[model samples]
Target: MSDPFIPFESISYTKRFLADCYERQSFANAKTVSYHTSYSFIYHLQQGRLYLQQAAQAPIEIKPMLLFYGIVQMLKACVLTVDPFYPENSTVLAHGVTARKRKKQGYRFLDDEIKVQKNGLFLHFLDKMFHVKQMPDEKYKMNFLLKQVADMHPLYSTMHNQDISIAVTQKSQSYMISDTILDDLHMTANRFSLFLEQSPNSKSWFHRQKGITALKQQITVPLHAAPTRYQSAPWLSTCDGDIYMLRKREDYCSLPELSIHYLLLYNLSMICRYEAEWWGELHHTFEGNDLPFIKQFLTSTTKKLPLLFEHYLFSINER
Candidate 1:
């Protein structure tokens, strides 16, 4: 008996293996367990955006379904990128087992596992963002998050209902998402990125940690208030000059803390850039009140991301 699991360290290898299996119809009898890296999710996210762009031109009957799938892919991408160590466990059954034995043992579908993992990730994000605690009822938590997300972006409500129907019936239905929904998705992604930036080590839940305590001590400047009017330099004559600088400085006092901010910024910028490339420019996509710090940082060109961050961002899709 040979080892049942096949390990792939690179996306190219994974792609080739899948393509070969697909061509041979090997998946008809075999199950695939994808051990995806952070970069793999990012790649899928980029592809999802591409599908969304295509959905705009698709016929009305199928447009909603396309958009729904696209948004789901982006959501999965967010979960994976935010916490690459998710699921936290792996299992492999012995190969060459009889189909009858597998049936008797009650095998689990990889798709079901993915849905469970993604739902957990979504719940975690909502709990932290809304400051909810000790919600033991899984169905209630899921419904609560769905309603909140729908309220935040009305388009999500329709999509959510349609998705639920599709899941229950295992059939596709016609649905449509507005261009405005893309902006909502962008804002949601930014908010999650900000949460990740603020607490890098706070992975399990929203509880305070000793690492955050140490980091907070290093942040001497206040993060709540806007910069004073006279903080501009004499050499600079631009409007609202140095406001971005002040905000960035106030957010992170040390290089390590700044690195976290850079990581989030890089991820957000990648999403923004992808949107821009696919659908012209992004105008008023983000709200100032919702993410003032992110708006400021993105508008300013005075500061550059750390060299290491730039390297990792560009190399994420490399073979």
Candidate 2:
């Protein structure tokens, strides 16, 4: 059987287009990164235009206009450009990454609005995506990273909110969220992917290869394979910013670690709602008095994830 996921024609067309584009424009005409690899460079409107030129040459029906060579190969390496009128960084562009599925058909709906950017749009796009470094352990200390994560844990919410429901999908049939959510999810997943790809000299989770592998696998499953805990509590969807944090505490919560780490980071205590076995939220507070406990909490939570998947996988096989 053929590989269900790879788009063969699209890959061939992109390779050929890259060669022809470099030939016509000259090497200097394209952007350069610190590395010599062709895919390593930061893509701009010029590169986007080159892709457009290639699309014109081959015109594959499935290809998207804006594609990134991911440091790690996963479901999110390719992204489509949309709403060219909006600045590339506009949060709306992130919304373009969503894969739509109808419950009856069980297939992803493709987007139609993808197009190449002219070089003029590159700088503006870069401006929108600012780098946020891991807070120095000291900064996390200030923010009560330990307490923050504990509070954000999804298990707490699941246990507390009777209105919320938990359902697990099999690995092969996971349902995906909307593009806006997918865009954010992809960006977050890519960050972890690259983190794992790098050979880090400093202290980091990158050293944990198994954890990284499991985390990476978690993001791309079919909805039926992925367990989802959603809240039906009123006023929950309307909340934004810190208010969302507040309302989340009041309504429903979840860890959703299988989805992305940040989701767990944002709603730590919420995971308690998903699995009653979780006890961290009830025991810990962001009191600024304890750091080791918080650090231990982070370590334990991250470690617990693999077991969660093991249980999920075992349950699926049993079914």
Candidate 3:
């Protein structure tokens, strides 16, 4: 297998990344901190790479445990680059989110929800890395989060018979979106256009083509939120190839991709660790939609997270 982190594993690469962060932050102790912190940052990322590599080959039963640790390691590395004084308190050391202690009967992973806590890694990571602070007590269902992942749309199409993602074509600086987004949105073209105008994410909404809608993203949009901040949808522009728009655009759908993955993986890791009875049944029995979604999700995250890490850390988009 080729190196998942070829030049990225090099110490110099992390040093440069840290140097950039130091410059961006203008830290008072940049000289001392950058030197010492680079070592920890590089190792955390390397360990993350290792854990995710193991997850890819590991059996389905053990994959989530590996993925959770892998994700945490990467998150720690990311935190260091952004905020050198991470773990300023013990609260940031915690996972920062909680799963239900006792799952109700007939529980499906899709319907299961996780509560964002007041403090911990989840809170710290999002606030530090993405500049977004969410309501701690809010609850999010697994299916809602999963729908935010564009690649997972196919499984949803198969199982739920829904199009969670729409492919977009680029036209110069803007992108051409599909009007199919309006189907489930219950909005006419004019209302949908009006909706985009009010959305924080929308820089400009061009006219709808034969069936295409076009918009340039407001790249500098600050990610602060009100209760209705998520009334808008998410638009991710890949460095290369196709772009996708998630339909419906509900709450959390507009969240940064990193946060989306972290939340999904957190719930998954919890189910893997705590809900063994249900997890075992899903794996061994392979009867319901749960196993398929679980298997597909694990597969999706394993492939996508590393590439996303590269983008977050180094501005490199591998795919």
Taking all chains together, each candidate's TM-score versus the true structure is: 0.25, 0.20, 0.82
The better-scoring model by lDDT among 1 and 2 is 1
Report, for every candidate in turn, its global Cα lDDT versus the true structure. 0.29, 0.26, 0.70
Pick the winner on TM-score between candidates 1 and 3. Answer: 3
lDDT of 2 by residue, 101-135 (tens): 21122211111112213232222222221111211
For model 1, the stretches where C-alpha displacement exceeds 4 angstroms are: 1-36, 89-121, 127-319
- What lDDT is reached at residue 183 by model 3? 73
> Residue by residue across 17-125, what tens digits does model 3's lDDT show?
6777877777877767878888888788889888999999999888988998899999999899878887788989888888888888888888889899998998888
Which runs in model 3 stand beyond 4 Å of their true positions? Answer: 1-4, 180-233, 236-241, 316-319
Find the number of clashing residue pairs for candidate 2: 41
Predicted candidate 3, C-alpha RMSD: 6.0
Model 1 lDDT tens row, 202-301: 2322222322121321211112222112111101112222121111112222112112222233233333334333212223443222233223333331
Ranking by TM-score: 3, 1, 2
